[model samples]
Target: MKMFLSHLDSPLGTMLLVTDDRQVVRALDFADHKAHLHRGLREHYGEVVLAEILPPVGIVGALVRYFAGELEALNELPTQTAGSDLQRRVWGALRRIPAGSTTTYGKLAKELGFDDPRAAIDIGAANGANPVAIIVPCHRVIGSNGDLKGYAWGLHRKRWLLEHEKAMKPAKEEGRTAMLPGF
Candidate 1:
């Protein structure tokens, strides 16, 4: 498969966008994880190739806008991924994570109808393994205490993403009974 690479500037830093003929495969923060990401991509896809795929550029633009607090819901990017059935389900669930919102691994597990909270860890693993980044929204997953946790790119980028989402989303009324908080 031919892959395309683009460098995008956002609030955090330069982010690298990677994609194939079908859809976006990776969106990585350019903080300190670039080398690691490059190695991983090389190992997974065997080689790195660049092509002109404008569809993903729109998604990258939207993401840049989102980081600037200009977009509330990211409904623009079309997600295409390669994974198992359960992994696909997990990716779908990640998309449901609203912009300027966050969800815990436990909450995500519950959304997938898993009874045990430990299933949350499995959900997290699938999220980490997601080939698509912002479009799939694995970064929207937070810890149980609403703390920013692991991201394939890095934790700093994770915090930046959560903050970006919070900036776009309307403020939640305190004590007004939230279906979810800290999102």
Candidate 2:
């Protein structure tokens, strides 16, 4: 198992993007979270090999467009991820959440037809385990109280993504907000 790793500059921050030989994204994590990314890779594909290389041009271009305000650029990009059935389902549901909208874990569980009270917690776990980031749109899911919650990357990145997509208003001088360009 050889995976290509590349650095991508985004409005939020530098990201470590990994892609399989087929150019399908395996994981996309913040450069600052390098340890977490490597740990996830080891967990997902035990004893793997990583090589430094440029990511597929198409994927990079799409992400560049996305950060440039073409929000739908990633809608059709191809992605392949490895996870349990529940995690896969949660990721699929995440992709269905339109760019400018959001959902809570509770509502997502209901959509999956889970009536158990703990479904949200389970779903949150799966969401946290998502390998690919923006492509899976995991940031689109928020707390039931309409407040931002845990984002493996960082709350500031989550807030930036939501704000970039216009799903959330830029935090009102909350200090956690990223000083976005083109403001």
TM per candidate comes to 0.73, 0.93
List per-prediction Cα lDDT, in the order shown.
0.68, 0.89
Evaluate model 2: give its lDDT. 0.89
What's the CA error at residue 51 for candidate 2, in Å? 1.1
Candidate 2, 3-95: lDDT as tens digits: 999998877778999998988888999898999999999988887799999768999999999998999999978778877889889998998
Model 1, runs deviating above 4 Å: 22-31, 39-48, 51-57, 167-183
Best by TM-score: 2
* lDDT per residue as tens, model 1, 1-183: 477776666555566677666654554435345676567566555676656444365666677666566655356666565566788899898888777678889999999999997898899888887765566788888888866778886665565556556623333459452222223
Clashing pairs in 2: none
Pairs of colliding residues, candidate 1: 100-165, 101-183, 102-183
